[model samples]
Target chain A: MRLRLRPRDDSYYEMFTDSANNLVIAARLLVELMSDGADREAITEKMRACEHAGDDATHAIMRRLNKGSAPPINREDIYQLASNLDDVMDSMEAAVDLIGLYGLERLPKGIIDQIEVLERAAELTAEAMPRLRHLDDLTRYWIEINQLENQADRIYRKLLARLFSGEYDALTVLKLKDVIEELENAADAFEHVANTVETIVVKNG
Target chain B: MRLRLRPRDDSYYEMFTDSANNLVIAARLLVELMSDGADREAITEKMRACEHAGDDATHAIMRRLNKGSAPPINREDIYQLASNLDDVMDSMEAAVDLIGLYGLERLPKGIIDQIEVLERAAELTAEAMPRLRHLDDLTRYWIEINQLENQADRIYRKLLARLFSGEYDALTVLKLKDVIEELENAADAFEHVANTVETIVVKNG
Candidate 1:
């Protein structure tokens, strides 16, 4: 091997990948929440466990950053990246929590559209985290997430209109809206994660 | 002034103060929304105008940061401060917009409690911005805002319990909850702003 100058701290990359992968699992849990006759209580419990896993991943990254073990990127970027990933999981968990709390049964068909967008975004994010080492390919990730966010917004508005269409009673609307809104927030949180990555690339790459 | 070597970009302080001051105005407008026979439409229109003004203030700061002006603090802190302040305004504006969209006739009594907390937080924030120059006195500001946020949370959950207490019909509950949730978000955003300020003081001061 050629003579190396500095030992690169690649653990940060691995930690971030673990965090993003946790989001993917959480997104799939959300998908299961949309399934017909699915055990939502069990799924919500699983989602809670998934969120805990995400918190552990986030805490691991933070502990490493605090150690100041020759950070691969700026401390703040790593903090923001960890926090944003954590935020996505939190939003997803909140959605499940509300679904159970409000006794939300028979979710609208439009909800599938919202959940699908989240699943796609989560998958894309998982794919993009490994590529963080090479920033050039991230432009595509950023563009696609932006587009996915837009799509999620549109689906959200449509759901809003449908809820207000007088088909469902107000209380039912409130419960469903709470669930859908959390998913939308999850999507937005994904975009925030992408933005942090872009910031990292622009500043360091 | 006698031995000044580095010219300080105190304009950042001024811009931040302006933004916080704008939130004060917006919060007061929210108070007016709670008034008996209040011209809510006119108030919402004014709130929209206030949000636009906030946007302008945020853009001015961003433009200044972009021009390579000597930021007294780290550039990221400035960016976060501006964005968090902007988020406060956006959430306030959204509350008003949804109130109008849902044609909320009369709000619950607990809403006044929420508005009062926001107004107080906004005032405290406006007072704190100038003291940013001397990061030492900021402890009171941070402590008070955190207390206020905790207060806001208690008020929110109480209101949620009240909403679900079989008092109002489901439709009204939906409308009021949307408005209340946005206000809660504004309070959380204010805390985010304080966190950024603390970060600045920790790193730079």
Candidate 2:
């Protein structure tokens, strides 16, 4: 791949790299939104920014897809890849958006714990993205991503067991569970991306 | 695309379609497993098969990726697409696996309701995958998929509120909530595929 190009001629790697960078920022925003218990309006505004930035990155990939030449891979596949990556941010923002929209102040211990795990997973994902620029190095971070995903799974399981064994009301059990699941799903998406990156290494390398 | 290939060559799509078809069956099995407490071991075995099938499909896509050839779309993008679709099955199977592994023979009404919604979502997804073979018809199912996703979201919200409102024991609440969240995540993945397909249509049309 040539380094010099017109503004619109950036390589596919650049598009995905930008998307990955946005994911890191979104992850950080999520931590701030939850841990700090920001005001509803403020959090919502931040989430909107996150969603917009993520969506813009997705569109950049789509533009590459629709550029009317052979993409590096299948167009539909690229579209899905871009969209799903954006979705990790979309889903996370939605969770935070709801937390604010629902006026959920004083986050629960279960949720806070899940977020901590999620933040760690996001950090791993951010680290993994930079490696994707060099496919050879992808394997290095791939295992770490998987480990983060496994850790997330364990946390999710423990949280559920605690929810069931404790004395909370039925509705509260449901709410906490939703919040935790969304966080887990966001982490799961990161794992999916990791899996995608791993496949790239196995195939392209 | 020319349909000029051996059964072995088409096996990827065949197996892919088969895995999706199994989604509906697995979901129905989930419903029955919930009702027929007598066949726990058998149902567990079947659920494992579903998980394995999903893994196989993921591997098949990776195999295609490793061949150093482009899929119908970009190679990297297709890898991500395949991984994301397989994940729906993986996640759903995990829920069923967990229920049985944890000996959750009897679940609360709310949890069951969420599972029912999940079964419907899976059915819709099963309906959607075959349409992929016909590129032109992909967008037709988007509305139905979006509707099911939205419905699942509503049920998730209502169920969680009930969980937290003090209807069940804390521990039980925890378990049931986890189950519900996994089911919801399964639905979320389907919605994602639908969104991807919709984008394909809008761009291609």
Candidate 3:
């Protein structure tokens, strides 16, 4: 196949990469939130910045798509991809915000596993966005994301049961659950991004 | 403008109406759950059946879409509408299920206000679906839904503040929070459905 260069369409790939890389940063900040003696205020501020950056990146994609020049791929896939990435950031940022809002400290130790899974998933997603160009050798990306999501689901349910296990007071459990739910939502959002990529690949391959 | 005699396309309207009507029923079931001696187990089971019926209606639309005839509205609009309605059902059902799972009996009185908002939103959504054919009078539907959503947001925040008001024990607070969160999600999903309808009307009209 000849390499037909589409210069204008190339930036969509770059914007997606930029957007996903923002998630990597936010996920790391989420991990930081789990750290003892972590400056949560500062980390939350940084996470807010990352989320705004993500919003800007998503808007850039939308602005480009709305300019009416045909994209390199299906328009719906681009919209879905951008929206899913934004959703992940929103959930991550929400998790950080709730920690501040509820003045919660000393979270359950089990949630570190949840935050780490998000970090790994973000890493995997960031690695996969650039692969959209070739649309080949991409099977592993979505497959791994699916596996990660299943792992996330298990971790979330276990945490839920533990929250009800009478270890903590009701108020503490309430606050912790809010933060955990947001992390779970972010993990679910990551899988949505992968699904969009899979749809693009299966259609174009 | 004269209507095209697209007889086969008319059922799409029916399916959407059916789907929206199912929300109406589910929302009403949500209301019943709050009543005295409401048979919590029975209502959850009924809510489950309602959710399954909602899923079938959604699948029927998808099946017809996959049959490859062009839909009366944009294909994306059909998908967005169905998916949004399904999301509302999922949240409603999840709310009821959590009530059973947590064995929660006395909810915050404020939540009754929240449930009523969702009930009204569901009713408005069901009424608006049949109007998609002409796409008229829907300006009121979306606007009212937006207002309802704002109202729902207020009700949700008030409830949140109350939960943390140091009234209930921590464990009870945690359990009630889960059920409240799902109801809040249902209201948000109703707004999503209205947004989809607005998109269809604005684009086509």
Report the lDDT tens digits of candidate 1 across residue range B8-97.
245888888888888999999999989889998889888988887887787678667756667788777787898899899989988887
**C-alpha lDDT (0 to 100) for residue B163 of candidate 2:** 82
In model 1, the clashing pairs are none
Kindly provide the TM-score of model 1 when superposed on the true structure, using C-alpha atoms: 0.68
Instruction: Give the runs in model 3 whose Cα sits over 4 Å from its true position.
Output: A1-70, A74-83, A86-158, A170-175, A194-205, B1-10, B59-68, B150-166
Native-to-model Cα distance after best TM-score fit, residue A54 in candidate 3, in Å: 9.7
lDDT of 2 by residue, B1-205 (tens): 1111121345344544555666666777678767844586777677777766666666666666676654554454455456557767766777876675445656666666667776776776666666665564565577777887888888889888888888776655556666777888888888776776665555445
Q: Choose the strongest candidate by TM-score.
A: 1
Candidates in descending DockQ order: 2, 1, 3
Model 2's chain B TM-score? 0.84
State interface RMSD in Å for all models. Answer: 3.5, 4.2, 4.3
Chain A TM-score for candidate 3 is 0.94
Q: Which candidate, 2 or 3, would have the higher DockQ against the true structure? A: 2
lDDT of 1 by residue, A86-181 (tens): 999999999999988988778889988998999999999989988886665887898899799979976886787678778898667767888888
Model 2 error, position A59 (Å) = 20
TM-score of each: 0.68, 0.57, 0.67
